[model samples]
Target: MTKFVVVEGRTLKQAMKIISAIVERYNTIPILSHAKITHRAEGLRITGTDLDIEAHIDLDVVDGGGGDWSVCIGVQALAGIARAAGVMDVRIERADNAMEARISVGDGAAFYELQILPEDDFPEIGGKQGDLIEMFTNGMLTATLDKVSGSISTEETRYYLNGVCWHITKQDRRFVATDGHRLSLCTYTPEGGEPASRIIPRKTVKIISNHLANQNLKIYDVDTGKLDIVAPGITIRTKLIDGTYPDYSRVLPSRHDFTLDLKRDEIIAAIDQATATGGQRGAAIKFSNQNGRAVIERRSGDFGNAKVKTSTPWPAGKVEPQPFAFNSRYLRDVAAGCQGAIEMRMTEPGAPFSIFDEDKTMTRVLMPMRA
Candidate 1:
């Protein structure tokens, strides 16, 4: 029996783009590089997973003559074929032996054979989704993640800190990320009451951020130790990191004795000029308050040195210049996302300070380095 499925080239191309996020480019397990295609009475569903994260997309098939049989096909191969197939429709047919499949592009003008893996070999991560947790628009989730993603830790040792912590407070729901030296917090109202906090891994955060753009999303069944996100024509399932997040509240400073307001563009340009000097790893940039004006300086023995000053008002009652130092790169990261006026609050040269927007809805905490 020859099993087959026919999908439009354009539709298959879009589905492949979403699946590519979960498909591993290099894998020891061959099945990890392939996408599972299942034909149903209603439509055709395509799924891809790397064991940690899985993505699914459902599309209406042009032809349903292909009997229902789940088969694995190389994601990259199919995507490449679709891209080159121009704007023509596509047809795929399974071999009688179930070992290979044929892809026909543009009324059989081009044809290629793709090797297949048994559907039974693909690991299944599906389960009965639990109770409804919370629902929010995709814009809200993307905005919150954008504010904190820069602070997510990339170090593998501290696996617990490598993702955003999603939790609910008495006031609102919050998304927080930190890498020990810096932290970011973003809050928004929740659709329902508080639910159990889950640490969404960094990779999943990125995938969700990409897919949720301009789409509405719902999060449910969090109690099952997995995060389920459903959007139009898309479903994502990812396992939550099993660990406790640190006490982030304690890290926020209670008092800031000195405050300076500066234009976001001016400050970013100064840092860019300083970083252009190319100093040692984690080089320091000196920020000194001199007579109500802010001075930025960077000294690199290997590359060179640069200094720029901006007219930023200093806190009152301070006669002597107060100087502080911070990692040049970290300061740049915080400044890149900010707009309009940015407020800097600090206590001393050694204390951690905060950089935030005028509204204070989003803030970043950075630890200073010795000059």
Candidate 2:
């Protein structure tokens, strides 16, 4: 229990801000509000969990003299201590009996004594795992989730849709989210893995998107409905939603009877301008197919009527598509997510419509509303 950790005060402060975010502000279990601190020759590792998700961050140490040790202390309080210390180096040492720890700055210029919880009481997701699967670059996983995050369902009744659904299609990984009104699907290449699917909770999706950047992660599917993510100095274990993800492929329109291509920025701007003059929330915008080359979106309000045009000819020899109406908010969100040009496919106004990006890695399905 003689091991101690020394780190720059400013560096400790920044690292604590990130790790403590994983610890809940309040919990009935005291240990759940604390972070597990482990120190070895290489550096210090700080970890926190909310039972469902566990994450850790590693910090380089200024001195590693007294061997290896582990302890648990209040995360929020530690961050406050570091902030108060300013640029001075901070040292942390555990009591001989291991029942408490002291965080000191500037040779006792400032110090705080905090009670320690049993390290073994801390919870982590651990179980028998199948073979670790192929690699997923941070850019791919984060970008895919960011695009679909807006469409993820927040309704409590059907809880499965509350997170992004990850699965394999043609050996490529696909992430999908929907709120029943609209669906967004993002595809990435995970290299190698047995075919499987899991619904990631919304909170976990946000945490991973924010912190796990620029590193390639290895994945493992555990037998207990949990997933493991491992990178060089980070490890995150998360529980998958226990429900089955809906079969979204059924909602995808089979044929591209008619396709209209437009610049991504142009369509989003048109959607925004047309809906600006609307009265209340949840306003619907109507898209009228005019001539063979143009479609007009117009919204009528008490002040005046607003009209904007997305002019692109229907593909040659295909039946002219009928005018369709959609929830303005949903359409604008899906359109804004496109990284490139928007290619829209439709059968009829009353039927399901599909939107594709120029690279074809992303797909969106929107249901039309009665105009």
Candidate 3:
């Protein structure tokens, strides 16, 4: 008997959006590029995985009573078909041979046939093997990832550093990422009790951010190399990076000689203007305090030089101005992470400086670059 399902195009699109981040465009294992669709009594479950990370979402469908059938179809093809569907409802039916599936828009307005792989060939990506850690709102998880994700190292050689370090200290829950030259740390209070620490891979971090952007979520089986994230109608199983994260506490500065506060928007505008002059191989921007004003300047041989100055609040002391140079891109990253005013605490010209949010929950450390 042929299996078939009638579903709403909008519903399919929503499920695809949640799983698409985990779908790999190209994979040695052909089924890895496809999403497994299973019909259940409750609803239709759509799942995508790349071996290391798996994401699934349960969607309500117009039950055709397909009698519990599972099949794998190309994610891109399925998404494309859904997007092109002109009507609200789309009908999907498997061929008599069970090797292909046909999708048709309302009353044959549009038709598409997609090849399918055997459901038995699909890999099973399991959930957490440990214990439930804690439950937190989706907003909290999203906010924490946004603050530290920018500093995640892209260098594969330092595999452990390629993800965000999630741990709980005596004071608060911490999310940290670093690329040797710069580090970002975001902290929040734990809900109930502390959870075990884990190094979340960059890919998994991105997937969680996309899926749980604004929902409540629960963490399970943390620190066991696998994590289970449970949210409304969705669950994500991701493998943590199997390595130890660096001791980030040693890098945070204990003291600074001067603190300069600049308007977040104004400093970001200045940095944007100054960095635009940077050519293909962009140069560093010089940050210096002039009297009671902050100035940012950058010069590129291929392009031209630019300078922007903004008034800043300086402490009431004989403040000695020191010039500090930093990568334009790094400075911009820190600036973008801040909400209100940007605070910079520096010890000397070449030493690392700290940038923090107004509430000080998020802190970024940046090493100086020679100008």
Candidate 4:
């Protein structure tokens, strides 16, 4: 290892980028768990990759040599120093089997030593091609992802819906996901971009939503059947799903003979009551429109049951009481944003039903079980 000049003034922002990039690939390989620092004439290139996803940043050094040198350090310590250390000087040194980083901020200075791994073991993730689409920064990207992300399936069997499906039509780019029980779909038009269809894996979409939420970023479609999301100094290449997604639009209820209009929270609380007595499977909720008030009742085989009577602002057509059983867990997922007002449309007790929020931008369809 060769000796190098220390950094006198490096912003917290630059240190954060280097730490994030290193940690991102730490778990990919044993060597990746260690940070690699290289010095060149241009600057210092801090890079990390797990062979699947990669992140790198080039920071200007105060004074450095022309030859490249590799020294591995613990990822956790680097991240901690980057977060805790304020503005000051940093002295990095390479020893026999370890690397030490001395961070100085204000009048306090702390030194940490981390075990080293061979630089050759660090993996590099090669870029691949998929489809790319550009989206403007605003509420459209974040809102769409937040509204639909929860509905993605955690089950490994139904692999198709495990991630959000990027369905692009001529007019709009849509995202759809389902867990075999309920489905959620959100759509937005690209401010200025091409239209293409792809399936973005679950984890990739989540990381992107967190980093790029409400921030403008370029979405690159790789030809290798992967989605490349670039936000600021972060880039995420998520593998695309090759399986066919279910025809979700067809699952939506077309027409309903009965519509129950009530507040989202009101119905959610009623469902919670039913869950307490009904066991994990869920209790039965009976809907009846008598006079003007809509009556909802729940009965539990084990625990005691309760009834919730709530009035609707809209007119309720005369209909017989419908006895239906639904998994309360499913109801909660659909009613998450139903704070203001919600509408439920159904044709029969055992038929599929649709629930809508106030804006109607999103709708959840729940299949009913026979009582």
Identify the candidate with maximal TM-score: 1
Better of 2 and 3 by TM-score: 3
Per-residue lDDT tens digits for candidate 4, residues 258-365, read 776777777777767656554646544665455667666666666666676766533445755355656667776677755477777788666678877765556677
Model 1 off-target regions past 4 Å?
A: 190-192, 318-321
Please list all clashing residue pairs in model 3, or write none if there are none.
138-215, 138-216
| Backbone Cα, N, C clashes tallied per candidate | 0, 0, 2, 9
lDDT of 2 by residue, 315-352 (tens): 65535566778888888888888878788788856878
Q: Rank order by TM-score, top first?
A: 1, 3, 2, 4
TM-score of 2: 0.86
Which should have the higher lDDT, number 1 or number 4?
A: 1
Estimated TM-score for each candidate: 0.95, 0.86, 0.92, 0.79
lDDT values of the candidates? 0.82, 0.80, 0.81, 0.64
Candidate 3 per-residue C-alpha lDDT over 1-371 given as tens digits, one digit per residue, 9 for 90 to 100: 55778889888887887667788778888999999988877778889999988877888788566588887889999988887873468888867665888888877888888899998898976643567676777478887887899999999999999999988765578889999989999876643245456899999888777768888888888445888888888888888898989888887888988888878888878888887755854369887666767788887777888888877754446767567788888887788778898778888577778887786678789998987
Question: lDDT for model 2, on a 0 to 1 scale?
Answer: 0.80
Local accuracy of candidate 1 as per-residue lDDT tens digits, 1-371: 55667778888888888899878899999999999988877788999998888888998787856567777899899889878876788877777765988889888899998899998899867676777666767477777787899899999999999899997766677889999988998765534355557899999999877767767778877446797888888888889888999988887888888777878888888888777756575689898776668888888777877788887876676544378888888888888878778888887667789878864567678888887
Error of 2 at 124 (Å): 2.7
Q: How far is candidate 4 from the true structure (C-alpha RMSD, Å)?
A: 4.2
Q: Which ten contiguous residues of candidate 1 have the minimum total lDDT?
A: 187-196
Which segments of candidate 2 are over 4 A away from where they belong?
Answer: 1-3, 10-14, 64-68, 82-88, 96-100, 106-110, 128-130, 169-171, 190-193, 278-282, 290-304, 312-319
